[model samples]
Target: MDMIVWAGAVLSLAGVAGLVWCILYVMRLRRKALDDATMRSRMQKAVLVNFAALAVSTLGLMMVVIGIFLS
Candidate 1:
């Protein structure tokens, strides 16, 4: 049970880190003067990664909640 809690915490933290990274990446993109095609490609990749990170974070949070309740 403790191990499960720890894993959940780690995963949630990782997701938060990823979310922060995505925010920073977007800021950098905004500051840069890239061409439309380049910007679109970069943004598309970032969006996909961001969505995955968000899903991970949500799952981790749910797992944590379940673990707590079960324990």
Candidate 2:
């Protein structure tokens, strides 16, 4: 139980870090003066990655909550 809680906490933290990175990456992309096509493609990729990271973070948070309740 304690191990599960620890793992969940670690995963949650990692997910948060990933999300932060995604935000910064998108911000940097927006600031760049890329051509239309390249900018569009990069934006699409960034959106996908950001959504994935958000999902991971959400799941990690849920797991942590569950672990806490269980233990």
Candidate of highest lDDT: 1
The alpha-carbon root-mean-square deviation between model 2 and the true structure, to one decimal in Å, is 1.3
> What tens-digit string does per-residue lDDT give for candidate 1 at 1-71?
76777788888988988899999999999899999999999999889889988988888888898889889
Task: Please give the lDDT score for candidate 1.
Answer: 0.89
lDDT of 1 at 56: 86
lDDT of 2 by residue, 11-50 (tens): 7788788788888988999899999999899888877877
Where does model 1 exceed 4 Å of error? none
- Compute each candidate's TM-score over C-alphas: 0.93, 0.85
Full-model lDDT, candidate 2: 0.81
Give the number of the best model, judged by TM-score.
1
State in Å the error of residue 60, model 1: 0.8
Residue 47, candidate 2: alpha-carbon lDDT: 79
* lDDT of residue 39 for candidate 1: 98
Which stretches in model 2 have alpha-carbon errors above 4 Å? none
Q: Name every residue pair that clashes in candidate 2.
A: none
